[model samples]
Target: MNVAEVMTTRVVCVDMDDRLTIVKDILDKAPFRHLLVTEDKQLQGIISDRDLLRCLSPFIGTRC
Candidate 1:
């Protein structure tokens, strides 16, 4: 099967300067696992849920 056959059309993207909180929020609410990082309307890179999770603080979302 081709990638287009199963690919999702509704993509989720984040700006380069966007915060982790925003990324986390998007991932938490969306069903997808990856996000396209862009700058000035140009694609810069991709960030997966795993990548965000790895860089997140253990105390994230916790009252410290």
Candidate 2:
């Protein structure tokens, strides 16, 4: 088996400046684990669920 055969063709991407809330939402709603960060249609970096969880505040979505 090859990478292309196992990899997803329908990619979900986010902007470089997108907030953690947006990233969290996307990841939460999607079945996939990775999100591509793009700038002006160019790939900037990749973010995973683990990355979002680490960067997001623990108090997020909580009422204090």
Number of clashes in every candidate structure? Answer: 0, 0
Candidate 1 structure, TM-score to reference: 0.83
lDDT (tens digit, per residue) of candidate 2 on 1-64? 8998998988999999989889889888998999999999999999988787666666555686
With a 3 Å backbone cut-off (N, CA, C), the pairs that clash in candidate 1 are: none
lDDT against the true structure, each candidate: 0.91, 0.88
Q: For residues 1-64, could you state the per-residue lDDT of candidate 1 as single tens digits?
A: 9999999999988999999989999999999999999999999999988888668756655688
The reply for model 1, stretches above 4 Å from the true place, is 57-64
Q: RMSD (Cα, Å) of candidate 2?
A: 5.1
Total backbone clashes of candidate 2, pairs 3 or more residues apart or in separate chains: 0
